[model samples]
Each structure stands twice: as structure tokens, then as C-alpha cells.
Target: MQELAERAGISGRTLRHYHQIGLLEPDRVGSNGYRYYGADAVSRLQRILLLRETGMPLADIAGVLDATTTPAAETEALTGHLEHLAQERAALDRRIKAVEHTLSMRRQGREPRMDVMLEGFNDRYEEEVVERWGRDAFDASNQWWHGKSVQQQKEWKARADALLARWREILQDGHEMDSAKAQEHAAVHVEWFKEIPGTPTHAGDTAKSVDMIRGLADQYETNPDFHVAFGTQEAARFAASALRLRVRRLEPSSADDLRG
Candidate 1:
């Protein structure tokens, strides 16, 4: 047990705790009263450590292992986890590059461009919007957006972050697509739309509020930038469905037009 624990870079007590939690059960109890792990156990232990290193919670790991059965299912789960990790890694890489660039500028006694330092952060949101709605949509919005003060822009971005964070939390809680909370989110989303200057006018109707909301949700579902922001395609779809339902309930005409 000690040897195996040392090999795994974990203490014997930790290994025993894993067994207690049914994560890594030993192969057999020897006549000498020692727990001995077989090859299968060792491999399982390695997988657990790999998942841990990738920042998965112990409980989530247990849930995933319990829920996965076939090799195909296991592979799918791993693929999803890997995708999430890859996104996180990309974000980290951007931050690293920004820091390096800033350091190089400082070494030359020059100021880094604040815009460059902050580029990828806001670009992701705009990229999602443009990709889903089209350059014309963003161009229209940008005309109104360029009028905003830097402080106002910062405020808008903070609100956007909060909105996305709430959506993520709702998904993490395993909320239903058409739940009351989702409708509330849709309502806040409508208000967010109103805050944007040219978006509502771009479609040319105040009564098309619901259509606008549903359209944005559809965009969120199909856009890769939006999928990353929301963390899962299912979550994006759920938000879209909920927003569509809300639109139907609130503005039947717009909903009908959009659905048509």
C-alpha cells in the first residue's frame, strides 16, 4: 500500500480514503492483512489522478464514473471534459501572452496599449454576436456603441459577465429549460437588449422585442463563441428554448413572425 501510494504521489491514508469513498478499491486482502491493488486498480487510480489534475471535483468524478458504462460513453465524457479544459487552457494562454507583451513594453519604457491588453476579453462577446447575426448587425450596433464613454463600456461588459455567469450557475444547478428561473433570466435578457442602443432599431419594431430575444437565443445556440461562454451547448439550447417560450407568452405577434 505504501509503495503504491508513493508511486501515485499520494499518502497511504489518502489511498485508503479513496477506497472508503469507493473510488479506488484494492484488488484483494492478502493473508498478511495488507491491501493489494492489481493492475486494474492501478490504472483506475491513474485515471482518477489525471482527472484530479485536470480540476474535476472528487464527487463529480465519482458521478461520472458511476454514470459511464460503455467505452463509447466513457469516451464521450472524456471528450467533453477535454474540450472544457482546452477552452480554459486557451484563456490562460491569452492571459500569458498579454502579460508577456506588457512586460516587453515595460522593459522598453513604453506603455502597453490598453486596448490590446483587453482585446480577447470583449472580442469573444462581439464575435459571437457578429457570427450569429451577421456583420450588418454588429455594424449597426457598433454605430451606437462607439458613442459610449469608456466607463459605460466597462459597465456594459461587467453586466454581460454577470449575465453569462448567472446562466452558467443555472446550468450547474441542473435547472429545467422552461423553469420559472429561466423565464426570469429571459426577462433580464430583454432588459439587457433595451440597454443596447441600435439592436432594437435594427429590427425596426418595438413590438418585436420577443422576436429579438428569441433571435439572440438562437444565435447563442449556434455560435461557438456563445457555446464557450455558456459552457455547454445544452445550456445554450435550454436558454434559447426558454426565451422562445417567454416570447410566445409575452408577444404572440412577434413570436409568430419569428417562428414563421
Candidate 2:
């Protein structure tokens, strides 16, 4: 047992704990009260050590071991783990490159480029958007954006800023629940949304835009930075409601169609 522990670079107590947890049981106990591990025990110990080094929780490791029926199954699981590790390593490399690029730019007294600061950020959001809305949804949005000219991109961004400023002003004025200005701002917002090439449209109606506005409101409630730009929760709610009402008025055909 001592020799095995030394070879495994683990203490006897750890080996004993593994045995207790059914991870590395000893082959047998000698008459003189010594624990003897067989070849199978050594293999199990090696697997346990390897999994631990990979940062898997003990409970998860036990579950994985329990689920493994054949050598092929174990190998498949290991390969999957390796793939995950490779992705993590790739992300780390991107971060490192971003940092190095920024450092180089700073050393040369030049402004750091967007590609430097946004290395891993773009992929994170892309993956999330793709997972939630399918590859076609992302591809359509990407294609639409790629087809736009630089001047058109600037115009779109300016329009978006104008819409956001309108929302902020509506909140700042303490507009009535049923105010004309609030409704007008909402109308403008919906119109701006319609002009966006990749926006999802149903029968050319934006009444379904209510759900998206509500989601943004919910996010604002938790994110202070978002709330600060949009004003208070009450204001955000009012803005969302106004937008929904305006969309309903503009697209009466789809107004009756509730979002699921």
C-alpha cells in the first residue's frame, strides 16, 4: 500500500478514502493487516487521478465511473471531455491574444482595435443567439448586416440612438400612463424596428414586439446600467406598455394574435 501510494503520488489516507467510496478498493488484506491493491485497483486509481486532474467533482467522477459499462464507453466519455478542454483552451488563447494585442498597441501609443477588445465576446453572444434562435436566424441576421454599406450601417446606428434617446426622454418627463407623447415615441420605435432588415416580422406587424420589449424591461430591472439608460422600473414598464399599445394599433391584424 505504501509503495502504491508513493507511485500514485497520493497518501495512504486518500487511497483508503477512495476505497471507502468504491473508487479504488484494495484487492485484499494480508494476515498481518496490510492492504494490497491488485492491477485493477491501480488502473482505477490512475483513472480517478486523471479525472481529478481534469477538475471533475468527486460526485461527478463517481457518477461517470458508475455509468461506464465498457472500455469503449469510457473512452468515448474521455474523448468528449478532451473536446471540451480543447474549447476552453481555445477561448483562453483568444483572451491571451486580445491582451497581447492591446499591450502591443499601448506600447506603440496607438488605439487598440475592436478585434482586440472583442476577441471572445463576439463568439460568446453568437453561440448563445444561435443556441436560442437556430443557425438560420443568426445566418439571416449576419447576411443582412453584411449586405449593408458602411453609410447604411452608420445611419442605422444613428437611428437606434435616436430611438433610445426618445425612450429616455419619455421616462424623464413623467409622462401620463396614456399620454400622446409616450404613444408617439412608441410609434417611432416600432417604425424604426420595422426598418431594420433582420427584424422578425409577422404579416408586417410588430404587435408581437411586446414580448421582446418586456424581456428587455426584465433585463433592465436586474442590470443597473440598463436601468440607468432607460430610467426607473416604472418608466421602463410604461415605455414597454406604450410600445406594445402602439404596435397593436399599427398592426391591428396581428394584434389579436397573442405571443406564446
User: Model 1 residue 14 lDDT?
Assistant: 91
The local distance difference test score of model 1 is 0.68
Model 1 regions lying over 4 Å from their true place: 1-140, 201-207, 253-260
Clashes of 1: 0
Model 1 scores a TM of 0.42
Q: Which pairs of residues collide in candidate 2?
A: none
For model 1, residues 4-107, the per-residue Cα lDDT tens digits are 99998999999989989988889997899799999988988887898788777787677666776656655766778888888677657656876898899899
lDDT of 2 by residue, 1-260 (tens): 99999998989899878878777779998999789989987887788898889876677677677786676666766777788788678668657876898899899998664421111114435685466445655555554654568698677666655665677677778886458998777656655544433334422434335544445445545544444445455655666667556555655554543221
Query: Which number leads on TM-score?
Result: 2
Query: lDDT per prediction?
Result: 0.68, 0.62
